[model samples]
Target: MNITFPHLGNTYIAAKVLFEGLGVDYTIPPLSSKKTLEIGCLYSPDDVCLPFKIMIGNYVESIQRGADTVLITGSCGPCRFGEYCELQKKILLSLDKDIKFIVIDEPAKIGIREFLNRLSMVAKDSKLSKAKKIKALSMAVKTINLIDNIEKECRFFAGFEKNKGEFARLLKTVKLEAIEAKGAEKTLKVLEEHYEKLKKIEIDNFKNPIKIGIIGEIYTIIDPLSNMYIEDILMNLGVSTRRTLYPSWWVKNTVLSGLKINFSKIYKESKEYLGLCIGGHARECIGEAILNYKHGFDGLIQIFPVGCMPEIVSKAILPDIERRYGIPILSLVVDEMTGEAGYYTRVEAFLDLIEGRKKLCI
Candidate 1:
């Protein structure tokens, strides 16, 4: 039961902690890169969204490295992501009939009994006692939340750091160290130590950097490669950025949703614009844009894959928010054919526009 899962931001780190704690064999695929995208493109239907292709690539790459089981979360939303597991499984099985897929879905969608059954598939392979397995799951949850908080702080504080690139450098080092740490306990220690280090870095409290809110498709926004490392690019430019969608946030939202608890404040903000979930995180994107403006961000940037239906809906609605609030918004659509040079150029121009607007107000 050697396990592997596709990358979705820092979820890979949590996956490693979970597998190790469970005392099971697992493989972490190489970070998503040009080669990963190329392999995914080669095997995927040309019309499917970018995430599907990249995931196909991740699974194939892991398969070559001795992973026989793939684990992924299931969604039964209107977005195409809901169908990913079935399609991806068929795609992988065609290549290797012996491969296995375990999709962890909401108990409401798949029934509590079936949900436990799917989970047991992985747990049954673990040599740990039942209590130990539960402990591992708890540790994995803690790992994800801690890492996400660290990343959020680094990105938002990048602009205020007295030394340029300090936050970015520390962020890179923290991820590297966390990955190298032997087990769940050691990995948590590594993150906690660096998190303390992050606080000691000097910053200019009075410095007012161009603050931007990032909103878009979940996978594109969370996965750096999919969005062409837009967050890092913004960090380099000394821009403060905030994004509410993280893997940990997703986990909490899913659990709350299963319990019929409406804990998402974003949904309330989105009610005026898009009151319903039309599949994907479209409503959240709309809500985030409005919320950022209310929070006094200078601008907003929305990134999503080309031909993504939900994001396209959000994109169309964004201009209205821009007009009503008088805040600037930039939308970037990426695909296999997206060029780096042009993408960066547009981002630079958008920053320039926001800077000019700030100066005029001063």
Candidate 2:
């Protein structure tokens, strides 16, 4: 089967490594863009969350390019993500797309046997042996972790770079070039070279620039198009930024969650505000805001799609966190109708507010 999946930040990189390592024929959906969102909106129900619409667009685009199977991770939730696969399947069928879907749920939720059965379906078409397949999975995880580290380094150092925009430029170039590499080993090598390049980029360590932490619903914060590339804007504005959630973090967390293990600092900091997993990354959002403040970040920016239930709850609690911790926060809600001018204006004002606070501190 020629398989496809939705874009979630650098996940396409790991997925490419996995599929190629398995020797399976696969298609990477075109990167999410305005046209992709428009196509999704045209076919999706008006009230569905933004991620669903974007994913629908990805599937439609992939199908047109000859993909017949879609792979998606499943969630059991008080949030709406759990219902997406069922709804999306019907939506595609109505459009006469007729694509097969494989939803990978947690083994604990769907049972280990069922999870493996679904996994085998993907590996079944591969020419690789069982041992090789296992090795490929391990490689993919390492690749994802490396990419995330590269991103974290880029975003955090953009403000301190001696050559403006060097980190941002290198980051874009690395991702584009890595995708063209023909095998997992080459891809890993490409990333390693890029990581080294990032480390060697000149930076002014003494420069004190605005430092902001981004926290919000997982999909919107991770996907550039969905959130209007907020992190890119912050980088271009010479703001150092940090985000606690990334695809690698999600992967690591999911694996350890069954053992009731979590990031202890996050759990402790957010305990006073939100004590339970309200589905989505709401708990992470609250905990990260506190964590970043403790780390001395000047401010925080929380972005989520309009009508995102989990983030809506986090947004309500954020003002109190800000008051208690003395950290300023700006919350941006985006959807198909989000206007660039208004969004940028608010970000600029937030920066000004933080700068003013800095001056007062001095």
TM-score of each: 0.99, 0.98
C-alpha lDDT (0 to 100) for residue 326 of candidate 1: 94
Per-residue lDDT for 341 in model 2? Answer: 94
Q: 1-362, model 2: which lDDT tens digit per residue?
A: 89999999999999999999999989999999999999999999998889999999999999999999989998897899988999999998887656788999888889989999999999889887899999999999999999999999999999999999899999999999889998999999999999999889999989999999999989999999988888999999999999979999989888989667775688788898999989988988999999998899999999998888999999999999989888999999988888999988999999999999999993
| Candidate 1 lDDT over residue span 1-362, tens digit each | 89999999999999889988998899999999999999999989999999999999999999999999999998888889989999899899999999999999879988999999999998777878889999999999999998999999999999999989999999999999999999889998998999899999999999999999999998999999989999999999999999999999999989998999986789999999998889999999998999999999999999999889999999989999989999999999999889999999999999999999999983
- Tell me the whole-model lDDT of each prediction, alpha carbons only: 0.93, 0.92
Candidate 2 Cα outliers beyond 4 Å, as residue runs: none
Winning model by lDDT? 1
Backbone collisions counted per model: 0, 0
List of clashing residue pairs for candidate 1: none
